[model samples]
Target: ITPASMTIVFLSITIGTIMTMSSSNWLMAWIGLELNMLAILPIISKPKTTRASEATTKYFLTQAIASAMMLLSSTINVWQTGNWNILELKNKFSTTIMALSLMMKMGAAPIHFWLPEVLQGTTLQTALLITTWQKIAPVTLMYMISNNIQPTILVSAGILSMIIGGLGGINQTQLRKMMAYSSINNLGWTITIMAFSPNMALMNICTYIIMTTPIFLMMTNMST
Candidate 1:
């Protein structure tokens, strides 16, 4: 049941990613994000155990907050710029809002408190999906908007994620949580290079996935 539910969640997140990638409007992107969140809620709670329920609640609350922020940012952007086109972002305030929302969505630093806790509660395979496939959409969107995002904000978030991910992993007992932190650190590397070369960012993302897959598989095998 858990695996099946997770598969459905993965598919939903893929759909959300497609929506996000193809969306020209902010509202559409928000809808896609909401879809992703809603799909994953069940997966987070599938264990039918206390820890899973706690994690699901925490994830739900965190995602709800992020969704609210996304809505607020979109509303502000529309009000200030009188436009909803994702690529039409022009005002500094709107751009900043969009960036903040994306940062939160991608589990970037300072806004990344939910990731470890959530991963700690899930099965390893679910963690793999969250760390890998589920990340594709937001990161792709971030790469697309890299030119508009503030360099300082990206740098700060990237650095913080790297430091926190590395330091946080040192004491983690659960292997899944450790991998989640590793994913965060890798995301930091990807974001850091995004400012320098968009192509490099793409390369980093590809390489990270390729490298991380084997590690995740190994852990899954060992755990079982």
Candidate 2:
């Protein structure tokens, strides 16, 4: 890619993520997420291979489904509570839908099937972004609605994620797929603690990034 194009892509991604993180209303958050999703597609498909194209398509479809669910949840909440504020998610059904959508976006639990395939098809740097930076907005949204979502669902998904992540990676030879499973496992821990302690969930995510970054950087340098 040209330098100008790369710069624009990265800037848009950053701005999109920041917008999602800072937005007070669901509409703004949805827009930010869409922008982020669009910005990352080119990066994921940069290799111009069939696998890259497949990965991009899978990522887009999965994210679009999650985003639509999120918007629908917000609409339900607005209908019930007449509020557009993120923190005003008082409707039980909306809260559950919102939580599930965020978990799907973050590649957690039973809905995490797309992550490994997507990571395997992308370059190392793009994989790194998928596992780390792209997670922040969804996690932030989860955190914001932590009080509203049912703890049992979050805890159940978290436990399932940990188990599946561990079992799924045992036979994988591909480094990117292994990292995908690892991210799911770590996210399980974060989501488990999110309902009980939001601060701890944040800390867990921060630590995951710190620990995972070095490994990805080393792998990239070695061309692995």
Candidate 3:
């Protein structure tokens, strides 16, 4: 039951990501986020362990807050700019808010405290999905709007993610938590370089995926 529920959750997140990546309107993106959050809630809570339940509550609460912030930011953007088009994010402040929300949703630094705990509570397969597939949509959106996003903010997030990730993982006993932190570190590398060159950002993402895929596959095989 757990595995099946997790599969459904994965599918929902994938679909939500697709919706978010393709949508040009702010409301549509919000719907996609809602879908992603709702889908993953079941997976987090299904383990039926005390730690798992606690992690689920944490994940859900954090996501809800992020979602609310995103909506508020979008509303502010629309009110100030008189446009709902995400592509026309001319208001710098709103764009910053949106970027921050996205970073939070992706489990980036400062807002990343929930990730290790959540990953620790899940199975290896679920962790793999969280690290990889769940990232696709948010990263795609980040890349799309990179031109408009503030360089300072991006750099700060990237550096914080790298430092926190590395320091947090060194003493971890759980393999899942270690991998989660490793992923955060890799995302930091990607975001850090993204500000220097778009081409390098793409390369970083591709390379990270290539390097991580084999490890995840191996873990899955061993777990099975």
Candidate of highest TM-score = 2
Clash pairs, candidate 2, are none
lDDT of each: 0.80, 0.95, 0.82
Question: Against the true structure, whose lDDT is highest?
Answer: 2
Candidate 1 C-alpha lDDT tens digits along 120-215: 898877777778766776777677778887788778888988998899889988888888788888888888888778789888878988888888
lDDT, candidate 2, at 88? 99
Model 2 spans > 4 angstroms off: none
lDDT of 3: 0.82
What TM-score would each prediction reach against the true structure? 0.91, 0.99, 0.90
- For residue 54, give model 1's deviation from the true position in Å: 1.3
- Can you write out model 2's per-residue Cα lDDT over 2-113, one digit (the tens) per residue? 9899999999999999999999999999999999999999999999899999999999999999999999999999999999999999999999999999999999988899
Candidate 3 local lDDT, 2-114, one digit each (tens): 57776787788888988998999889988987898888777767777998788778888888988888888889889988888877777788888888887777788868888
Clashes in model 1: which pairs?
A: none
Error of 1 at 58 (Å): 1.6
Each model's RMSD to truth, in Å?
Answer: 2.0, 0.8, 2.1
